[model samples]
Target: MAEVHGCNIPEDRYYWIEKHVWAKPEGDVVLVGLTDVAQSLAGKIIVVNLKSAGKTLARGKSGGTLESGKWVGSIPTPVAGEVIEVNGAVKANPGLVNEDPYGEGWLLKVKPSNWDEDAKALVTGETGVASYREKLEQDGIHCQK
Candidate 1:
């Protein structure tokens, strides 16, 4: 894990910095989740509504909706894909996102339409971590660690 402004960002996942989402390849599908920074910014998540399995989403489109404290926003997918599975646990206990944004708090599983093409839009590894740190600083955003 990499720490940027006190938020834990696992290098194993690819990030859509502007969207505040992460994607991890898992065989034919990819797991999607909120970043720790996103969870922290949203405060305590209270509700999550995910798109059903089989729903096709365009890159940068809303894949789900999350409500936390006074904040309610969409969780966008970094790539175009079909939702393979929705994380039921999040719907039942949105607080899990705040507790563990990258683990049990994952949003859904998606079978990408063009992973190779879309993945180019994301940043990963050390460069990604550094980019996120810079973006957070520019936005004056601080992780609530």
Candidate 2:
């Protein structure tokens, strides 16, 4: 795991630093979730509204919305794809995002329309960790416990 301003940015995932989102590929589908930085910035998540399965989302578009004490905003997807799955657990208990943003709190799974083209734009591995650190500094984001 990589720590950026005290927020965890796991090296295993691909990240879109500006969007505060992460993607973990599993075969044809990619699991998507908000980063710890995002969860921290939002405060305790109160709700997560994901686009329904089978819906096609264009790259850089809103895949859903997340609400918290501090704010409510769209969760933009990094790549265009079909929503293959949406975590129902998040709908019933949004706090799951606060508890485990990368695991059980994952937002959705998408079958990317153009995986090779789109994923090339994401940051991953050691480079991604470095990017996360830079993003935190650029945004003046300090993780709040």
Candidate 3:
């Protein structure tokens, strides 16, 4: 497991270092979601509005908005492409973000037009874990651990 600022970063994820998002390869398309660190920083999510299907989104662009209590923020898409799917489960159960973020709590499914190009921008495995730690230290966020 990866940890940053005392936040959990499961090593299984493919992280978008810049956008603060992550993706899991699920067949031809990918299952996208916010990393645990992101959710913890964003607080308790209340509502989410995802880019509809067939909607075109730019790489690293905000594909949807995340509302957490009084905080409102965007979840940038890691890949440049159209939104093939959105998680209705999250829409109905916004708390799922706090429940099982890496699993059913995922946000979008992007059909990356340039996986080879964009995937390189994201960090994974040990490298990703290290990066998240560095980012937290830079931000003066100490791990809860």
Listed in order, each prediction's TM-score against the native is 0.97, 0.97, 0.91
lDDT of 1 by residue, 64-136 (tens): 8999887998999987899999999989999999999999999999999999998899989998899899999
lDDT at position 23, candidate 1:
92
Candidate 1 accuracy as TM-score: 0.97
RMSD in Å for candidate 1, one decimal? Answer: 0.8
Per-residue CA lDDT of model 2 for 1-145, tens digit only, reads 8787889889999899889999898999989999999999999999899999999998789999989998999999987899999999999999999889999999999999898888899999999999889888988998877
| Candidate 2 ranges beyond 4 A from true positions | none
The full ranking of all candidates by TM-score, starting with the best, is 1, 2, 3
- Candidate 1 Cα errors over 4 Å, as ranges: none
lDDT scores in order: 0.92, 0.91, 0.81
Q: For model 3, what is the C-alpha lDDT against the true structure?
A: 0.81
Give me the displacement of residue 70 in model 2, in angstroms: 1.4
